[model samples]
Target: MVSDVLLGELAALAVLSPAAAFAALGAYLLLLRTPSERVVSRAVLSALSVSLAASLAIWGSAVAAPYAFVPVKLGHWFATRSYAFELVLLVDRLSATMMVLVSLIALTVGRFSVAYLHREPGFARFFLLLALFSTGMLALVSAGTVDLLFAGWELVGATSVLLVAFFHEREAPPRAAVRVYITYRLCDVGLLGGAVLMHDLAHSSQWGEVFGGAPWPGAAASLGPGAATALALCLFLAAMGKSAQFPLGSWLPRAMEGPTPSSALFYGAISVHAGVYLMLRVAPLLQRSPAASAVIACVGAATAVYGTTVGRVQADVKSALAHATMTQVGLMFVEIGLGLYWLALVHLFAHACLRCLQMLRAPSALRDAQEIRAAHAGEPLPPLGLAARVLPAALVRRAYWLALDRFHLEALQERLVAAPLMRLGRVLDRLERRWVAALSGWPERAAVEPGEPDAHAPGAPERAMAFEPAASDRKGART
Candidate 1:
């Protein structure tokens, strides 16, 4: 309809607002202009406000039309004989609602950061990452093509890692950042592979072609059960990492190394729900594959139990909340797996708002605990019922220890995944060195001093300094 054209322009405006903010802040930082905290905060909030307004308008239009699916064309980025890429944004109830939610939360978090991070050294940097995430999330929610979605997905992942390592001066933040990055890289292969398969099977990456374009929730998937199963499994792998399910769940608590505000926004609210959103968006394709749906349900149930158990044993408030988030998100995933689409969406939105508030008020946790204690006159509360009471004492102790160690999931990942890759890397490094030596027609140990020895030398450190002046002649050379 012609009215949908107006809605399309509005959708474009919504996506562009946060992008503009990112460009503005990026320009200021790159130019070495010391931005005032107030100025940066105002600029970001203003952009978010504009984006929020546009998203509301889009939602209004979608409601009026009821079942309309509008696509706003931003032109093709490239084309070839067999492949093409375009920037297209879809407007439906699902996407419009998501845009509204993302903008609203981003605005709230942006405002909170201004006061919370006042005069901190990396104040500007924090805002920059926030703006980047806002832009990416908005784009991802609205993307109508696999190519566009992948672009937005990568942007969000990059910002997540950077924010995790915001306190670069600290040792733990960088290590946590590395872990997050590695997990993302490994899990992202699913998304990358899914996109390729979409092109190969559908011959086009557009939502209309890929999912038969019936306007979400009602859309029929174009793929057969077999192809759909393969695609869905690939996407499930991506969702597992993003949602922190099972073996991939260890990184969620560790991500708390950044500032509290970031922990609130990224893990507590938006980033953690990205995987669930992905599942909801592709629900139609999932319907074509019973196997994929079963896997999703099983994983979600397992994650819920895992999160709840680990949360009980966490020593710190943030980590406890992180596990709690995982628990709730797992429930949402289960809802989606059971074909309860609207319920899952509502769960995602409500959980996000609630978790944001809890994370922001986390610092006051001690004060709140004291108030409760005083109210109760220092008496401990009665124990809540649990299965532990029925178990033997030794078995209870073992369960407690297992829960405390987060079931050793991180250790399992390192041994099964990281250790093997590291060993392979070292082997390849040796082979590469041999190849280079062969190509250059030089012996591998030629650089070592006669008495010093090579890399394989015994009883002494390998003095294999490359092209260094002889140690005996160093004094004369200096003279």
Candidate 2:
């Protein structure tokens, strides 16, 4: 449904601003030589400002009076006789909330990035990726179809990967990023599979019928029961992986390798909470799946407790923040699990604001405040009074231990995912070199050099990339 007040004018402007900004961004990027990071970063903030204004105008128009939004049909794809895809934008209550959240986060983080990435080597790359990420998120949140959601999902994942590996010189960032994309691949697998399954359920995935009330003869009634439960389960697995819940949660702490602002943008908001937005997008299906919802709750609870305990122990500011994000995300999942979908949205909104502020300001403020207090007093305050100042001493003691050990998840991952995978990989490497090589006479080329130079090898044309496993390591992968 569309707005009812100056609906045409508001919708027209909202649609135009983002499209115009994107086109301008693409054109300038194509022609430009070496753009200044400051200039580009400012441009990001400017675009965000404009987008926010445009979204507010549009929201002002969402009157209860009957209305509908017809998104510009940019393009389409056909998978089969029954399965067709298209890039059609849709603006409804759901899409609008996302627009607001994404715009707000982009503006805040975009501004923060200016100072954080300033004079850094990858500064330009950082801005470009950030801009692209925001663009994709805006599109995804405002989209009308599953295909559009997938496009936006890919965009978010791409931006996150770039940011995660922002410090490519280090082993940790790159390794963490690799693990990050592995989960992304898992997400794509589910989304693609779900799309196929959905088609069989409803003859079409068009925006007009899927979410509209009067059911399409055969759509799965509720994601809560039976076959619906299966779809819900798949969706849950995908969301868990993307949101960094337990089994796939390790990538996040390692994800701290990016610049502080990138970490702030991702872990603090935007990409990290993307799964929540996605779940909301399918609230109807989700509301039905009690068993699946139970799973979500369990995972959220597990991740929350684990993340909190670990976050408290972390000695480094960034790592502590990362685990804290895990804890809050778990809490967010609690809202989702409780079927307080609206509250989940509210929690996501408020929590993002508070956490980002705390992360960006807390580290130095503690030392500064304590030093000032100590100097003014010229003597230490009583332990009891000091304990009452902020948190209880017991809690602080707990946090100290939790943050330091990372709640032992590090050890768990090494044993379960990484160590086992490495051992199997070595065995597979030997097998491939011996028996497999005997069958196929092609000589193995080293991975460091990708291939014999092809036409696009020198300056490759950018294309939509799926989540693929990392092959060669720039810093980590101690082979």
Candidate 3:
């Protein structure tokens, strides 16, 4: 049997390996010019290999002593009279499994990207973000407290956004990145709120304290129905966003703007499964809250229906795969809500592996289709999919239109949420401009004439009349 101290060391190594690589690569990029592609690939691959080894070792130890749950305390971040924020790491069946999966997938993607993105200008930047993502995911899986998990969660989100906008010169990637960032930010409030609620109700956000020390799926949370329900709902909201559940899922298809490797890593595999991992980690709490479970089930069912309907009508392979992934993820959520925690975990693993493979091969789909047709003696491929065979003609046509328009979810969101927010932002911008003018003794110029275009409005020309240069400034420019 592995000693507890050895297990602690191994778990810490699993998380720190990638973190150290991220720091070193970041420093090298900033201080020195971009290192050779070989160097970047080696650094990232080596880190992932180490992390994977550590995770496997931890897993072996847990298997030797079935139902093992180990909590390793690194140190305290701060100490107060009532609360001491200690950095803790956990090694358990679920976490060890997740750590191994994340490390393996990241390593595979990093290796594939070397050849796939060869000669690309942003090679170093891509590897750097990949390293950061690996570290964040490792930390998220192994974190012992909600506070630590939240930090890791935010790190993952930031890296995701950066990678989505990796092609900084492209207009669409940045816009898509912004959309994803907004969705993440808005939903992350649930995680923040849940953390606060846990601290208040349980007096500690530590998993051991909140869910008890027993191993997961068997451990029971010591909370009243009311408290458990509230906390469960909040965490589920966070899960809904990360997993791309209904109404909040539109941003996911757009996320395909990033590189194929990134799309596979983030959407097809580990990143998309993060929410299911969270639900599994908190299975005990969900068991205690029937109301919360019902809500989760309803949302999951809706998303599953939505994804399946829209996926079939997608004209592109990547978009189709994105929606297909959403469909599987939604079913996983349904499994969790139905209290089939083990089944949900199995589904997550299988779907992630399959989807990752599909996404990696997505770019070659057209070639594959050609090969298939040639094998069939160049006969036109017969119609595939159940929709054509099973659905009534009228129903299929109606569904097609709805799916093609994505059920107008985006349009509704634009009118109800995004438009209002933009108007508010414009109002705030005008107020700030007026305040600045008052401070700079240009108050008169701040007043806008009726029907005149706002100088800062989109596509409107900059009005020189807004701020005429002073005579002394003009003379200085001439000299």
Candidate with maximal lDDT? 3
Clashing pairs in 1: none
Q: Which is the winner by lDDT between candidate 2 and candidate 3?
A: 3
lDDT of each: 0.85, 0.68, 0.88
Q: TM-score of predicted model 3?
A: 0.90
lDDT of 1 by residue, 322-348 (tens): 999999998988888898889999899
In model 3, the clashing pairs are: none
Q: Please tell me which predicted candidate would have the highest TM-score against the true structure.
A: 1
**In model 3, how large is the Cα lDDT of residue 460?**
50
Model 3 spans > 4 angstroms off: 378-383, 424-479
In model 1, what is the error at residue 312, expressed in angstroms? 0.7
Model 2 Cα RMSD, 1 decimal: 8.5
lDDT of 3 at 212: 85
- Please identify model 1 stretches exceeding 4 Å from their true place: 390-392, 443-479
Better candidate number, 1 or 3, judged by lDDT: 3
